[model samples]
Target: MKRSDLSHTIRETLKRLPPPYDSHYGVVPPAPPEEGVSVAGAAKALDAAQAAFGKVDAIAAQMKDPYIVSRVLTRREAVSSSSIEGTQSTLDELLSVEETGDDGARDVSGKLRPSGGVVPWHQRIDFAARPTVGDTLKS
Candidate 1:
């Protein structure tokens, strides 16, 4: 019931799989607590999470407007998400594009803006519009 035991089983199973089909199948089950991790390691991870929560709570308590913090973080995440999709735009540029409602916003290089240049207002209205597995893991 150790990690090595699981790896060994997966390795042997893979050897029996044929080409094309081999890469298509996987046998990785979540390890039960009794099989996978040491209790001490779990305790340490829990303690770390609690400490992080306390620190974030303290910071939130001091913020005059927590909504501003949420807005900034959301904008940052938008920029990062766009970057992952090969769209290069900054927060200020994104805001300007949104304000102007223009697709012709010029980049610093004076070229036409990209598709993700401005997050569509509809997408912004609902943060729950999650990417599908294919969309997220696309090369």
Candidate 2:
């Protein structure tokens, strides 16, 4: 529809959606591979991806400290999200907080301080005491 043909007001146009549109939108499924994408090319890309994953899997399996990978990834994700939330936090600060066990010592501690802050379940449980693993009620 051209702008010249639109005689209705902005409010009128918006109030009623045309065909294939409604107040609620449905989820769109993932698109199929493009028509031009050759089966050979797709197979080659899949092979490369599988090879890379195999190398990573082998390295991860051989690591003495597997949890370090998790910590590193968590810190990296926290650092990236800090900017979006208008917080100035560093990877070193996050690592230090976790190591020192300061108040609000979490991945996002720099963002959410301990003053009426949301606490993670990990912090609630006293791991040192080991009082019935599931019982977080123990003070």
Candidate 3:
């Protein structure tokens, strides 16, 4: 906005700045309306959210086998962390690996494929890690 408009706004807000920038100012956003949302609608949404949370809590609390939970969490962590580290695999692919004991398979092109059937995102080859000529040679 124009400096003059900013100065006028600042004066209306009773705020002051130092030096030549005394005329410069930032606009303060107006507070939200107290009655913006209907109370009944908000209450219904909250109830639904609470019900979903309670269901999850109940399932977690009722875990009959600790090993099952541990195994699930471990696989989740592995898949998630490996994706972050670029040695990526999906949870389903990881589970498939555990079941089949296969590290990798070749696609029709004979190139290394991430997983079978549809191409999962994480399984796509990361070509950026490939070493350039400079990487292979001395200075």
Winning model by lDDT = 1
Selected candidate, larger TM-score, 1 vs 3: 1
lDDT of 2 by residue, 20-136 (tens): 676532333445777865689889999999998788778778999555555565566666666665554677866676678675544454354442221122233323334464665
Which 10 residues in a row give candidate 3 its minimum summed lDDT? 117-126
Top of the candidates by TM-score:
1
Of candidates 3 and 2, the better by lDDT: 3
Per-residue accuracy of model 1 over 19-131 as CA lDDT, tens digit each: 86764545555557866666798899999999987887788879995444456566667777776677777889777876797767788999887564447532473355445
Worst 10 residues of 1 by lDDT: 121-130
Candidate 1 residues lying further than 4 Å off, grouped into runs, are 1-12, 15-35, 39-46, 90-105, 115-118, 121-139
Q: Write one digit per residue (lDDT tens) for candidate 3, span 22-139.
A: 9856456566798785589889999999998788667767887433544555566666777566664567866666567565744346576665422232233223334479976952
Q: Return model 1's CA RMSD, one decimal.
A: 11.0
| Candidate closer to the true structure by TM-score (higher is better), 2 or 3 | 2
Clash counts for the predictions, in order: 0, 0, 0
TM-score of each: 0.46, 0.41, 0.33
